[model samples]
Target: MPWPVAAHRSRLLLRGRILLDLRHPGAAIEELREACGILDVEEAADAVRGPALLDLARALRESGAEDGETRRALLRAQRAAGDDPELLLPCLAALAAFHDAAGEAGEADETYERAVLLAPADGALRCQLLTAWGESLLRRASTRDGAGIVDRAEYVLREALKSLPARSAQRGRLQGLVGSALAQRFRHLGFLPDLFESRHLLGQAVRAAADAAVRAEVWLQLGRVRLEGWHHAGAPVLMDALQAYESAEREAQAAHGSDPGSVTAARARHGSGAVLALMGRPGAARSAYTAAREQWQRLVGALREVDWADVELTRRVESEPATGEGRTRAERELRDREEGDWERVAPPWWPWTGEWSNWSEFDRS
Candidate 1:
């Protein structure tokens, strides 16, 4: 390939990466898909092809596209990551997320377990993995609290938090996660400390979050904590719950003028209605509940309409192609050339059990 063409393609690909990092997945997908097209027609190495495919897969998955095309992109990336498991790890993670978005929780958990199994011993990778796992558990807890997952999430996050500097955004994120997990546990086990700590950590998360919607989510979560407190502790804290719920509503309204299909926003609206009812304002409570119900219904409708796209193209490309794998070496091949290779592949953990599957006859304690 000509230097000019390669340079142009690389530039586009880099721009796509920037867009993704900047939270513009729709634009990133368009640019990265274009870059993939350019590299696909040329004699690109797997190193080049793999990153492009992986990045594009991420863009697709982030945009909530879980169709045959997304799966194909991830599978091509899996093949490209054949020699370097580290490269393959992210593909698996993204695939798991895709499954989660598609409402296939069983498959999603299994895929994530595979990623955990293949996770490199690198600290950053492990931290990211824990973050992903915790987030997954939190998402799954929408139906039922995964007490085991929450316990493990808090443990893992504690370790990860120690590595991050005080007051950093990453640290703040971990704090928020731990708080969320604790709140789930509090509901299941009635731990007062968990409820109180949850409120504190959620407050910190709201302060640290740069995105308005995220901050709104934190406040909504805090509102839940207060409500839970009232339910478990009695009427003394009913006013506290009402205040928190109103705060949640104020934050959510400022974040999105309309409901915006956010589960957090819906819950906030509902919380406001419940709080008003508790405060003896039936008319106002009815209005709040009606608004909340309409928003909740809209969210359900949008979720049901989600569809996968471009399947035949994806499936056919794999069957017709004979892809080369000459440049599929791991990134560590270059980075750790002098530092010596890591020879150990640690055992994978079981999400349901919160234990390592590779360890035999080991005590859980």
Candidate 2:
């Protein structure tokens, strides 16, 4: 059999294996590597098959192959394909994903921009690429421009929304991505508009998502938005959010047969605890917080045994909160300050604003 034909056959077989054996991570990784190797051989046969080579590069990256191998594969394909726009977009998108994973934010940003330019009319593609770019910006915001990057992310998401076909499956996914982007922006800017937008979009996502895991994630985001930013209103919103996270967690465990990091269970527990505390349920809050703190501590302890050179692991480590009494004190103080600030500056129509003081007093009575 000719090498090119064999490689094409191998690619097809590997893709089938990937779709059929999603439960086996090891099998998926093996199939991805097989696909990558076949594509490399095909590239040697005909250097101009840019799209095929780019697909191989993306497969390798997704399989957690070595960064150098993935980069070399992509660069060779890009050089072979030259300036073909059809070839460049996937190449750029794959490179963006690789660079972002490798912590090369600047390179990721450049590649993502190129990818967006290549496929400006494809909303779903643009949304996926911009989400990658936005995440990279969020990661390195302190060193190279902050709010501006967030603003750009907001604009990109809005533009992506304009391209979405209403009531379509693609639009549903795009809505979740947009909502997530808006939530991140709110975290950065503390703007009520962003929060409101995020809430609205996330609500849409929850309604549109058919998958339990996806719906759960949308619910988790909505919960975090309310609990963290909306002054802990003691409304039913927090409970609703908790239910969503719990549902997601349960579904993830059943499907994956383990905690698959689906909903960030520890964070959910802590947030639920915080909400409970604010609602004058100290005992339950304490239990929930203790569970979260233990989980976080165990994660930190596990990390301490691993090599810090693992950039992805290092990133996870950086995200873990310090535990014990110190964390409790800090969390309480931060929430108090935020609540006080909101009380002073909240819009008149906002439920927590003092303009509703008489109503609130009556309700308390």
Candidate 3:
């Protein structure tokens, strides 16, 4: 209501923060802007300006506004926070997520790497960054990519897990993400070890997850990995994979029987069809596949928008041959997305212009 000045700075700041948390970024921006306006940075403590500016940047970013003003606000927040790890950690994470949500994977990875380095002992944050980085790498994968990315992603996820305390919530999440990544890697390179490891990790994730939906998804992933393994190797593996898919189907049914057209639900149904087909049950598999196809059509019919950003019209996937990476393929892809056209949006630090992309150059004291 009343303008925020010295006496009411803290209260205004708190209100802005609450609004941001409640996803009312537009309202938060108003309070934050006026509050910050009332106090001069040179006169205000770093604690005050740093956090307030960071929140303002967050407000800006969350409101679907990733303009230069928002970028400058984050940079100012960083400068105000200086070398305070407490302030810097969150600022970096916000910046990284901003990049990630904007589809700027390279920038997100770079920012996350800096955050990881900034807090070497903070396993939780390190695990978070590593997990995000690994995910980005996998998403950047193409048919032209090599197995090294899968290898690197698996390694990174393993390392990410080590950062969390045993059996912690964060640890469980990383385990699930790692499992998903491993499954992807196995699919790419046809590596037995990757499939086995993926199965193990997904098992842990399934056990740890209390939510039926989450566990269902993990079961589906594990089932797919096992099914692929069965395709390449036979006998006991085939049976194991069939069981996994069946388990996934059961979980999916339990989780979302009311929502037959949901992504996970359709995936489960499709996966079950794959299992049926693999087992040479043509009649049953045909029925299952038909059902799955109907579910997919339902999904397409349900799209609220003519062009939903969430749906990819065409998915471009380039994968290496079983033999190895090809010269032309290697040139086009990153060893799991380490390299690409992303350079256009990633030429330099958008915030600092030219003052080093990372926080290493900052003075601690």
Candidate 4:
């Protein structure tokens, strides 16, 4: 006999409850696998199953499952569920985020563009999508297009903030994201004025963040802005920026735990190392670079291994040149070579007056 309607509904609801309880990331992924197994066994064409399946796919994506599997599951569920636009939006957003994580910039951009089109009135989602879109553009821009992307980023961020309620908790996070975007814009333009604004906004974000990890990110960005403008400061300012980055790193590490897959901690280490290198402290800079490099290398390796297929993300971590020591050696060699040549031809250019023979000897002295 066909299953009773109420009994089928109860079974589906029970399965959903089981999935919801699978909250730990690892367990959630396993639950998704189990859900797939259950669906396969049922093999029944029931419209009611679509929403539950979509939820399962979303849970899998958020839990850090491979993108291909998540996309396939979401697409199947979405199609079976009659492609409801509202239902599709979350899956689209999740897919876009997955592609972004995987470094598939073109795919991510396209997905987010479609998502924004679907939800035109969602100011916050639009802003987040636009910021991400602008980031991809900035990465790929030749010198000609980078500035325009930055401008778009700034406009979108402002618009998003304008749409938000004044007391929204998301305001702080949005401000931090905008500040980071502005700092990138300034860095590309080599303009100091924008950086001042960036620093101010980042300071506000730092004060407003309730989460330790988010606060660390704000402080790290602030340190980066200060370090970039370090030429304006003496040793004291440089030291202060270094301290800020170091503190940020510690806090991020504490909040995320060691090996936390934390982009913030990795970035903080890199920023700290760069500032140390600029301050002429090679040993400390090398140590920081080593940590940053390790994190970046792991991420890159993960990407290369065809893991994290849902999102396409790329990161470039730079370290102080190992050839820095060689610079001193090269300089000494050049000076010795010049001295040898001079010794051989000293007569006419005696006392180093050859290049300035027209000047009076007293003036030369």
Question: Best by lDDT, which number?
Answer: 1
Instruction: Give the alpha carbon lDDT tens digit for every residue of 1-365 in model 4.
Output: 24664455456555554655555545555544555555556774535455556556656665777778767876776576455666665556655665666778778778877876775575555555554554444344323345656666666666666666678776666677667667777756867777888778877887777777777767776786766555433223667778778877887877777553455666667667656555545577668767866765665655532223111221222332432343453353243334452122111100000011110110100
Estimate, for each residue in 1-365, the C-alpha lDDT of model 2 and write its tens digit. 59677867567655734543353433455554565466566554433345445544555554567778778877877676577766666667777777777877678778778887887676556655655565455334322235567666556656666766676664554576567667676666677777777778978887887665555556556666655543633433445655654554454444333322322444445555555554444566667666655555555555533222222322332343422333464464455445563332111110000011111111100
Clashes of 3: 5
lDDT of 3 by residue, 1-365 (tens): 34444558777777988887687999889888877876564367877787777778777876767578788887787787788988887678667766765678778878877887886676555666676666555555422353556676667767777777776755555677678777766656766887778778888888887666666667766776666554445423545755665676676677667343355555555556545444445355456556655665666786622222212211110011121124343332222124323221111110100011122112122
TM-score-best of 3 and 4: 3
CA displacement after TM-score superposition, residue 353 of candidate 1 (Å):
25
TM-score-based ranking, best first? Answer: 3, 2, 1, 4
Candidate 1 least-lDDT 10 residues? 342-351
Could you arrange the candidates by lDDT from highest to lowest? Answer: 1, 3, 4, 2
Positional deviation of 111 in candidate 2, in angstroms? 1.3
Displacement of residue 133 (Cα, Å) in model 1 is 2.1
Q: What is the lDDT of residue 184 in candidate 3?
A: 68
Candidate number achieving the greatest TM-score relative to the actual structure:
3
TM-score, each model?
0.64, 0.64, 0.72, 0.61
lDDT, model 1: 0.61
Q: lDDT of each prediction vs. the true structure?
A: 0.61, 0.54, 0.60, 0.57
- What lDDT score goes with residue 219 in model 2? 59
- Per-residue error for 206 in candidate 1, Å, reads 4.1
